[model samples]
Target: MELLLAVIPPLLCYVIFSLCKIGFQKRDQRCYMLSYQCHKAPEDQKLDTGSCADIVTRNKNLGIEEYRFLLRTMVSSGIGEETYCPKNVIDGREESATHMDAVSEMDGIIFQTLDKLFAKTGVSPSEIDIIVSSVSLFSPAPSLTARLINRYRMREDVKAFNLSGMGCSASVVAIDLVKQLFRTCKNSLAIVVSTESMGPNWYSGKDKSMMLSNILFRTGGCSMLLTNNRALKNKALLELTCSVRTHIGSIDEAYRSCIQVEDDLGHKGFRLTRDLPKAGAKALAMNLRVLLPKVLPPLEMLRYVITYYRNKIMKRSSPKGAGPGLDLKSGIDHFCVHPGGRAIIDEVGKSLALSDYDLEPARMALYRFGNTSSGGLWYVLGYMEAKKRLKKGDKILMISLGAGFKCNNCVWKVLKDLDDTNVWQDCIDHYPPSTIGNPFSAKFDWINDESMDFARREDYLPLLKKHSR
Candidate 1:
């Protein structure tokens, strides 16, 4: 036993050290993260690595797009609400369906998003040294992260980390995590994917506080790549400028804002609170403080001090949240604020004093993809990418909230231009423009045919009863 123990520890250490060597060697040349762009079976359909290499070698012309987006690819579970209609709600003699059933139905937003990512980035799993992803709300039995790791048959040595977000701002939080690991490390690849389970996570109870959640939050997600290798720096995907993390204490009053937990009172499932707007505001203030060290320029810091005293001595002019002269806009040219809710968006917009154009990507994302939670930022980036607004040197600011009662932000440096040639560029043709208000609805269909959980859905009564919205 002693001999075995000694041998194992040394062996493990050697393996880890060896992995570090490989990690750095592949740093920047790693393949892209797959988004839901192409369902066509790759040359290696059931065999993951074969397809991965195919993807890696296939996207040679991707970055050639006319515009450039700094951070990463946008993704989501295809929204379930795109098919719902408000007029149908009023005329509804039909059931008030729940989203659980439709969870795995066709055109799943998540699948397509992953496809888009793979097609655009031209990355495959075999090429990745690490897999880092997160989803808030929906969790499959075997776990999606594990499924991906296994599906890709990633290098047996590949490192994997999957997270379930408990707060509203967690998507960018995942980005922060990915950025930290990639900065000190190299060659190793990190795929930061964020998503929400709006379908299954939805509330059906009459609790007014909880009822509000049903009114807000839509489906969406985002996926981005990170590598410290020098080879990939010329196109500069996103730079890990810095990050700020802040959390607020949770209490009943505060709780009413963002949770839908199954509490003591036979709480069937899901709930919402009305105070989310204020809670989000409070959280954002803390995150802003955290985000400062990264975005604050020395000149701006000096100006902030000057503004603080000037406002105090003037005895009348007081800035609303953070003190005066702290111009985040001056520090970055783009914004990807999470579109959690209209109120939340209004709050962030007002607090940052960002103009409509500055928030156009965010609003447009919300209009198109809904509140994909953590992954929502990618959608906004795609908007910028599609619009060809991002330039080689432009900076983008991404911020989000999460169920953990936290707020987070990430900064990106545009690398190459957004080439219209990427496979996903044509997808825009399928979606309606930003003007179509109420462009989303939530529904869950029975997936007995498409899923392995057929037994679970066979007992249809309870499942349908659960959908009694």
Candidate 2:
């Protein structure tokens, strides 16, 4: 009887251990977005409309209508005066920089951003288990992965990946890749860097479709640190809850919507066709069709299903299906829609039935920083953080459209109340202004040179003189 009692206790302990082992192995792997940093270019690179017109006219490749389209697009495109240009491609340069110049610019951006991020998180370079980077336009020998490794002197066994040609959605793609790796790597760290090499890819060609690239693509990058280390949850900013990706490259028209080609004049440029928004909407719908079922509240999903069935299956009157319209706010608290362009933002917001408040971050990011390609979503998030709009348990939907007709969506839950010190600290207070619209069309009499002089005398002179050495 004594032997039997001892066996019983040991067997119970074994059973408990086995159950815990199974539970731990089966538990979902959690990925945390610890922190991110954006590289703010120097002020000299700001390209206003007048400078853009001068550059286009000097290129001598575009005709009158093309120039007019660029100017009109610039005015209504949501890009403000703060979008930057590479030093080699700034106004009056006559020629954009060579491939090596692009490499140099990217090197500086990537290094600086990573340095800032590490300093912020206090995560050692040696602690990073994986390195993933995405740059859409340029790829050289030794690869960007090699450059990062050599620059940071990361561990020799650290796995590295350099993703190219994926375009703007590449950042989330890199995030998804890192999340998948975290499943096996245990409590390890991954660094995802997204930036563009714009100098070499500048189009001097006459193709109207191709020239759109020159006007919209700008210089920027972001570095993000993600980890599966549960101990770091207190310091982490967000928990990645869901990731969804859809690729429609098989469709011929969608595939050609954004493509890189050598123009008739043999100048290389990316062609962004007019049909891009329509194709992107379709792709976004397909992604959400799968994603909404998983993340949306039950009633919201039922409403969408009922509306969809009544319109298509029940042959009832379908009012909003004729255009983009859906009440996604019922499920999502905040959205980080890709600020690819003004038209794209408008179309996606309309399709999703998002209010102006829901879109303020994206619009403000575009207005303040132009499209930063793969890093654009991070800028939108930065704007939200800067404004202190996020709250714990709020759901943030991050969606981006890229080349290869791709749509990527990631859902995140705010882990805690985020601090105000972020990338947008310098300009947050100046934004989401008293009014919101196309900055070019908006009339502000008080902002003229005369009014500005009065403000300088009344407000700025004392501060300037006090601080001036």
Candidate 3:
């Protein structure tokens, strides 16, 4: 048949592309699953401490500016509202709080979100065979993963480990690790948590060169479940087609572009000295080099072959960063870019050629919650769920960039209708409607006709001019 003949060549190209993913050097800069963590809190706020006495105790100790800024950002940002603070129960001093307590305050939110994720995945905590958590800050006795295993009191055979100091890219890098584990085993379940302890990591010093990272990053977390069994794959939550990682050399400038340290003013934090947009583009180019075989059909490649060559010769840099360098937009039905900052999201949107509608969730997440770092994607995903934009077989592409000059991504296809109208949804209704600058409205008073002035803000896409750097 004519249709059959037409499909064969494209299918063949996909098969070849799939094969190319088998081997790749893992590259991750710390985002979606990779980046930073939250602020520093005292003993009372550790996951083990669940007393109002504790949050209040610690809240009082927090600097006024810090508390005011965080409250404004997290409260107004449209990320889901939930057990804002989940703490561990130690000796019942605080009976039962949230997992927020036991999470060592490395930014307690990541794990709390994961608990909801567990419920969404429909996999019992007991059903999980492995627990792998990555957070750049915090160490807990009976690690956070162990607490989950204990809370479920599942089988004693569950494998658990905690990893930190790895950049934000660890989630996919961690998933890749789990993939190898499941490949060697059968019917095993792995839960990977990627979060950043950003609350404590915010840079607060006179080092103007390093403070940029702080301005961009916010607080958030993301979790993923991976399984190798074909049986499980049939009923899996999200089917990951594959993943790719690529890295540029991690030089001093790149390293210091986003470095963690205690500032001269005694404010210890992480900073960014990057023109990060450029770095992100470079990594994307490299990933595409390896990704060509998997998604591009030979016929599609034929169309691209000319286009690719034409760009190589015909144009260099336009006023807007334009003329075909990587079309991240078409490759994904939805995107959950890190709510790193307003500028970051704007740059990402412009570079990828995404429309305002396509970037609504990311901007809303930033406006709503500040940046929850590793958890940022989940908040954006929460927005998508509120809109019910996800359907089975819908493919979502996520990309994160961070410290090691790293970049990594995952492509997920929904296997079923995710019951997203959960706690986060209830929380979102509390905020003002978010739009282009105030996509999620500002909680405080706004000047008259502010939204009109705000419309001009939409044109603030920084990476619009190619070769501007």
Candidate 3 lDDT, 395-441, residue by residue in tens: 78776666567777777667766555443454456443643332112
What lDDT tens digits, residue by residue, belong to model 1 across residues 120-140? 677776777666667655566
> For each candidate, how many residue pairs have backbone atoms clashing (under 3 Å)?
59, 0, 62
The most accurate candidate by lDDT is 2
TM-score between model 2 and native: 0.87
Model 3 off-target regions past 4 Å?
1-122, 198-219, 311-319, 323-331, 417-419, 427-469
lDDT of 2 by residue, 97-145 (tens): 6777878889878998999999988999988999999998888889998
Ranking by lDDT: 2, 3, 1
Compare the candidates by TM-score and give the number of the best one.
2
Q: State the C-alpha lDDT per candidate.
A: 0.54, 0.82, 0.56
Q: What ranges in model 1 sit over 4 Å off?
A: 1-112, 250-256, 263-269, 319-324, 419-469
